[model samples]
Target: MANWVRISSRSIGNHIRKRMNQGFIGSAVDINKSSGSSSALHGGRTVCDRNRRYLNSLPWNRATLFWFQRFKSTVAEKQQDSFLSSDTDDDQLSLDFPGGKVSYTSDMNFISESSQTRVPCYRVLDDDGELIKDTDFQQVSKEAAVKMYSKMVNLQIMDTIFYEAQRQGRISFYLTSAGEEAINIASAAALTEQDIILPQYREPGVLLWRGFTLQEFADQCFGNKADYGKGRQMPIHYGSKKHNFFTISSPIATQLPQAAGIAYSLKMDNKKACVVSYIGDGGTSEGDFHAGLNFAAVMEAPVIFFCRNNGWAISTNVWEQFRSDGIVVKGRAYGIRSIRVDGNDALAVYTAVSAAREMAVNEQRPILIEALTYRVGHHSTSDDSTKYRQSDEIVYWKNARNPVNRFRNWVQSNGWWSDQQETQLRSSVRKQVIISLIGLDIHNLHFFSDT
Candidate 1:
């Protein structure tokens, strides 16, 4: 080591020397099988078995072809633009230098003010409930599709009632996964319940789909004796060790690194499970997101970082999130595999996450997913959307682009669901909420019986 100056001279030469003198930090995972024995037991399934199970559940089954036959014929009369286009474009920054012609440069950004290409958002269906992607559609079985739709609807209904319960002073606080039902349930549907899930506050639907009861949700929110946390945590923060779902934390992006560490531990144990960590577009702004992603990539942690880019961080628009390309680009920076999915499309999210799960565990690599969606409701009860954004903007996403309704139309088109099913499901959900909320007094519940 030598004496180094903290300040540098004012010149490009000094800047170059300064950068070179700085120590380079690295986070990389050595992709190797761990030798240590794992005493912990997983779901009694081998890696190959789980892979086969996942592949079999994909849209490649016989039902997919038959369903598309009827779906295509009905839509043949309609004229629409093709949906199967390349996800990227050829856009380069060229410069005429004194020596010769030069095209892209890593050291210098030739085009500063304008973007070279648009970040592609992956989608399976158009808003009109048509298969827009030219590639063979990823299809779920009719049963699976119907199940996914029901869960999506269930999540929406839960948010509505719980949110109202908060407004009526039944609960101290709440956060609605309103516009994000697809991100919550669809991704959860794609994953095995044994795979660990570390979530921020907005992903309660993951627990709901993993057999967490409606009464449990109410109990946690109301801090009753039945709550796993025993009423010590703030409302809406829930977790279950049995379900392998980690409790929600109010701190943004803190779960990312934790997921990476857990995945690394799973790798050491040679377990076939991967870790999936979820964060919002706003959470990406946190420093933990960077550290977690870099560590996961460098350490070869089998983690999938699911970022729900809902276009707002509290009142801050995504425009304020960052100047660079969206969150997907950050994955590239960390040397991790990444994708951009249509967050509002249940099938698209499910397909993407399912595939990501395979790649993460089998290949022993960290993956990132940037889901494009909008926040349809206020951030939480503490927030008011009208103060920072326009009502029309919210209405557009909430109505025309509601994820629940969009997927419902697709499933119903195949005759898997109908009005009667919808009515019955909604009624059942309402009754569940009523039972959960009314059984015990708001305060002095069993949780309060102790000191």
Candidate 2:
């Protein structure tokens, strides 16, 4: 039995050494013979001291040392006996799988349904737009803050007018960013122009931030000859190569895997930018979402997977979605760092994205941000949310938790804006939208007449 145990241990050690040589383990285990300490070098960081101590307590043999090092875990320290110890209790044993460490037990046990703990949502501002005490955030200058508010207002107005145009049969379809204006604009404000964006259909505010003119938006939505897509894509399927924005695809979750690949490309070329991919809560249900996250995590791609958890995917509410504590936990499942932020709080979203961008670029890793907000508008011109969700819920989000109102309150608290300025900005933006539409109409008419 002793000889058999030795042989098996040697075999396991050989396999581990082979894996290490193939770069699976990245680097070799380093043993400090004089100090009686053992450490593994991975990516230039020392292995945890606990792991070092656990390794040192083992028999001083290559096979034994490699085996423990490969499967080190927090619960491992309790199991100091030989692997073949008949006195060992099943409850004291731990198995370290590729996913993570798990304790083994002889008792019939099952993971509880109540084990899912809701992740805390991060917020810097209250519903009334007052900063919460003891909260920290990246501060924005007055000029930058005002610009963010203006763009959010612009996006809201644009959505309203364009949705009206679709209803008037001037366009085919439209999606509003009503309750999510803060998310749309604040996240865009956090990123640089050099960063690539893979947007779902609802993020026109990003393009607006990148200098995509109202005329350009109108042309694309109208599918005119002047449109960059040359009338091939549908309305709201907007993209601009000049702006580093990928065209929106109708299929759900397709952009996620693509974003991972783009991020990998940027990393290979040593670019100082990252990729930001946006998805709705419903999109998280797709297989592409899993594939994208796993791929990015394994490749260590610099990408930010931003999920707009707006409580509904078309007519299907988020309750009908997966049962695991929302989308942020899915990031941990894939070994990606993640956070949940208040999407209605522009300051919170901006601060979270700013930190996420820095970490993604500097660490060359992926991040998942689950922005908790409510969809105050219908899914699109194609579906009515009122049919499934309560009218009061919509009204509550639109009024009590309105992103525009909350941000305007913050700006007003600083005395940076006034009612007159608000009135003038709204008037100016409304006129601009109308004028852009009229200009597109005239240009199209002239082209047809000449033809």
Candidate 3:
């Protein structure tokens, strides 16, 4: 009787076939030419060479061997032709497989660092707040533009006052969307009232834009009797069912999968709306991010994964987070359409999100947007960003790339906003925030004792 090794061709063939399909048409074993060990042998025979010969000598089906050899030669010849033929369309040089069509490449090269080949950020305005020549963006009417700017200003002032209150020990904790005001307000402006918003802690601007009043925000933050959460949740974990905005949570990336489910629910009900889920660059590192994106893609859910890549996750810098080309590329891995945008450019963010929402709803597919911005403030009241990063870096983003100032510049260039109007808007917003805080303190004082 012959000694027999039960070879599972199903598994082995699948593995080798997958490798071959990926453009690996070379020899199975490589000779160590650099070490001058090409001829080196163990027990008078090279290990790989001996194993190959032994495998070939097995009593296998002749037809199976012939088929594999033919397949290998055919793929190798086609790959060579593709490389040598200048007239061949690059798009045509692809291998159709179970997953998808993979483009063929002759060079065995690993992808370089993301920094060397970073995705270009989409921008409508320069750092000086002037529109880029021939820039394509969704045009905003003066009224709508003014409203967007006012909401942005309102959000900025609210963040400033709330952060100060936290510092003064009036609030237990707070998260300010200081440099990220545009990302919040602009994205909110692009969505309809029917759209669902699943926000991280930094997206109170969405609530404000959706008509959550200053008094409401103050109530929630102060956790007064008028607070929707009734003091059960922490400050800044705001939610308004009336506005279709889900409650904010402290757990990182937990909202991602929830967004997918909500979008799928909307799809099932045949609603003409999509879900917008927001996250920080640091949140993308969570396993929930992958699960959420995969779930949305697999379900063909109408959802937009909005990533605020502000270059930090608390103390962790983005470089230390991942090696990929930021958060946008992760969308591609999950088969979701993605784009990178200038988070500081309000028009750019609004335009990108407007188009993204349309595509997501019409095509019933997931979209990922990475808004590249900087966090000018500390991560939260508990964090001191200066401990981890330079103050000059913060100052540069705060002064040069200030989103509120940039949008104000655009509106002023159009003769729609003036210094007088700016002064009035700032004063009025500050007064509203201050009044709301004062009212909340008085209400809490009486309400706390009664409760």
Candidate 4:
């Protein structure tokens, strides 16, 4: 509503008028008068034109107009900055002044920037096969090694069976943690039966190790009459309250905070149970990751944050996704103790997770374990990995670090397992899976319908 008049030359004004025509100034003045009322202002629609003509009426002095124009712009900028920026600092600007003089100085130089940098990963196995030992490495017993090998083999077979079921059109979708079997099986084997396991989308091997029957898995996958979840969730979103395995969420990293809350309740009740929640490297980018970590640390929640740093989250590699460091170092920011392990090595995963679980239970604090693994399959049955990834990478991983083969060789070398026993176990499990598939009513909607 305030008017701003500036000095300009009469000749320049005359030239502008010549271009605009004779009645322009009069029309502008009329518009300015009508601007006070809504009806007149809407009919005329010439407030901008009136202001230009009024400015043209003044004397043409460059210095005065330039300084005055700058002053007006400065005031407008200050108001905008005040509205837009969070006014947390005390010395920003105090508009409480006599006669309302714009008292602003460029205080941008005084603002402080956070100097924190990412911490590096603490690891047992380096990129090469060399070992980096610390007090953290707990030696696995021979018995534990045998158990680990057996579970890994069973898991591999189970994954293949599920994939075949999906291909046979018995299920809508299936995700096998094909290459990352060591991480899934070994970590679950290390935990107590009472301890809670909250898995992300790909860790079905953990549930299998936790005593989930083949028929139970088949029911859920096929959404059959016996499915516990009533076929409400997708195939891989598994849950078993009896086993203390929390349900899987499609939204990445949401379970992190929920796990922290569960841990807090366990702490309050003075219970021995600790929550072990799994997530991928992609989930780290989410705000929930930071919120969960911070909350767990602040509350001393007995939660183990397991990050499967699987080199790729559906083709977005860790290098493209994060610059700070691997997911392990993220724990340092929240004061939670963390470690990185060779997720391919079953022994290494079991050892690291054993120590992490001890810390969570005995120390009454949260722990983070970043397991470096690879997803051998496409992200899911719905995905096509060949589109975004190189064929050589998959071949290399498949040949070099197949989890089942690695653990199998280790067990065979020690005479813990024999070829005969291995063949018998595989044949028995395969027969069981085939038998379960026969009764699997894939098309029956009774499980999901009305329940």
The root-mean-square deviation over C-alpha atoms between each candidate and the true structure, in angstroms, is 16.8, 12.1, 16.1, 20.6
TM value for model 2: 0.76
Give the whole-model CA lDDT for all candidates, comma-separated: 0.76, 0.82, 0.82, 0.73
- Worst 10-residue lDDT window for candidate 2 reads 69-78
Pairwise lDDT winner, candidates 2 and 4: 2
Tens digits of per-residue lDDT for model 4, 215-250: 888888887778888988889888999889988879
lDDT (Cα, tens digit) per residue for candidate 1, span 226-270: 888999999999999999999988888899989988997787557
> Cα miss at 90, model 3 (Å)?
15
Ranking by TM-score: 2, 3, 1, 4
Model 1: colliding residue pairs = 27-298, 28-298, 28-299, 29-298, 29-299, 29-300, 59-139
Instruction: Looking at model 4, report the run of 10 residues with the lowest lDDT sum.
Output: 67-76
lDDT of model 4, residue 143: 84
Task: Score every model by TM-score.
Answer: 0.73, 0.76, 0.75, 0.69
- Residue-level error in angstroms, candidate 2, position 15: 34
Which candidate, 3 or 4, would have the higher lDDT against the true structure?
3
Tens digit of lDDT per residue, candidate 2, span 1-451?
Answer: 2222334576545544444333345335565557644455533334325333232212234443443332222122233223224333463586655544466668997766544468899999999999999999999999999999999988988888788778889998888888999998999999999999999988999999999999999999999999999999999999999999999989999999999999977875579999999999999999999999999887788899999999998988787887788888889778788999999999999999999999888778899999999989999899888788889999999999999999999999999999999999987787777668665443343321110
